[model samples]
Target: MPGYLEVLIILFVALLLFGNRLPNVARSLAQGIVEFRKGLKGEPENQEEKKALPPAGGQQAHGIPQGTQGGANAQGSQPPPPAQQQDPS
Candidate 1:
């Protein structure tokens, strides 16, 4: 266990290292904790409007088409082979 003096020294070092950004770091940490707690409790993250909206036509929830992969050649078709160039003698 650290003594009071040792704790104070550690805190002082932390303050020096984090100087102006400490408050922002603390705020971000708090927000992360709140989000984690909400996840544990199964609470929605303010996405009611998004949940109510319908998915676009022919698209899944992730916006990708239902029957196709996210590629131009999603229909299992292969590209045409390139033509060979003739060498000049």
Candidate 2:
């Protein structure tokens, strides 16, 4: 972590460089980082992970494989449709 003095110096440089848009710039950078992390996890950018390990209602959610756990849509908020078999012809 950057120390207080280092942080203050960085802030001073930012104030000199960005004048007034520094906060907004920082906010956008943080949001971008969060989105990137979610992408890396194959998760939706802003959705919360379900507590599937606990099985919220003791029954499986619709469209999800029985006894399946982890990943999003675990709570059935946006369960994927059933898979269709492909033709071999």
Candidate 3:
């Protein structure tokens, strides 16, 4: 087992190496912990916010256009031809 002095030295070196990013690292770690706890309780992180927002009408959802939900290429456009490869002689 390492002594207290060895642990302190390791922590000091780590602080020096990550001094500038320590706060951001700590913040992200805290966020992860909160997310994990919410998951344990089966609670979504933004359920209330999602419910509060009004739905978007006549607009694309999940990148699919309003009338192109059931089929691909619903705009009557043809797919581009495959590129021709040249010989590397």
Candidate 4:
């Protein structure tokens, strides 16, 4: 880890290179950290990017075509045949 003097020297060099833009750079860095934390928590910071991603499942984001079901349970299964009924006296 760097000592206080090394930290000051690095800050001074950054000030020399970034001058008035230092605040903006710091703000950008803080925003990046916040966004990173949100991502780590399984949340997206950018709604536009979220909106642009494909929807869940195999269906397209646009719309499902005419008569096709778009999920796992809809794939391949048949109902059991009905049981025979007995007449009551």
- Report the Cα RMSD per candidate: 6.9, 13.8, 8.0, 13.4
How well is each residue in 1-89 modelled by candidate 4, as lDDT tens digits?
99999999999998898899978989999999998899899987778999888887755445666456545566555567889999996
Quick one: how many clashes does candidate 1 have? Answer: 0
Clashes of 4: 0
What lDDT does candidate 2 reach at residue 88? 100
TM-score of 2: 0.36
What's the lDDT for candidate 4?
A: 0.81
lDDT of each: 0.83, 0.78, 0.84, 0.81
What is the C-alpha lDDT profile of model 3 across 41-75, one tens digit per residue?
Answer: 98767989878766877555666666667566556
TM-score of each candidate structure, all chains considered together: 0.45, 0.36, 0.46, 0.35
In candidate 1 the C-alpha lDDT for residue 74 amounts to: 62
Better of 1 and 4 by lDDT: 1
Q: What TM-score does prediction 1 earn?
A: 0.45
Superposing every Cα of model 2 onto the true structure, what RMSD results?
13.8
lDDT of 2 by residue, 2-89 (tens): 8999999998998898988878989999999988888898975433435334456677667878657666755765869989999999
TM-score for candidate 3: 0.46
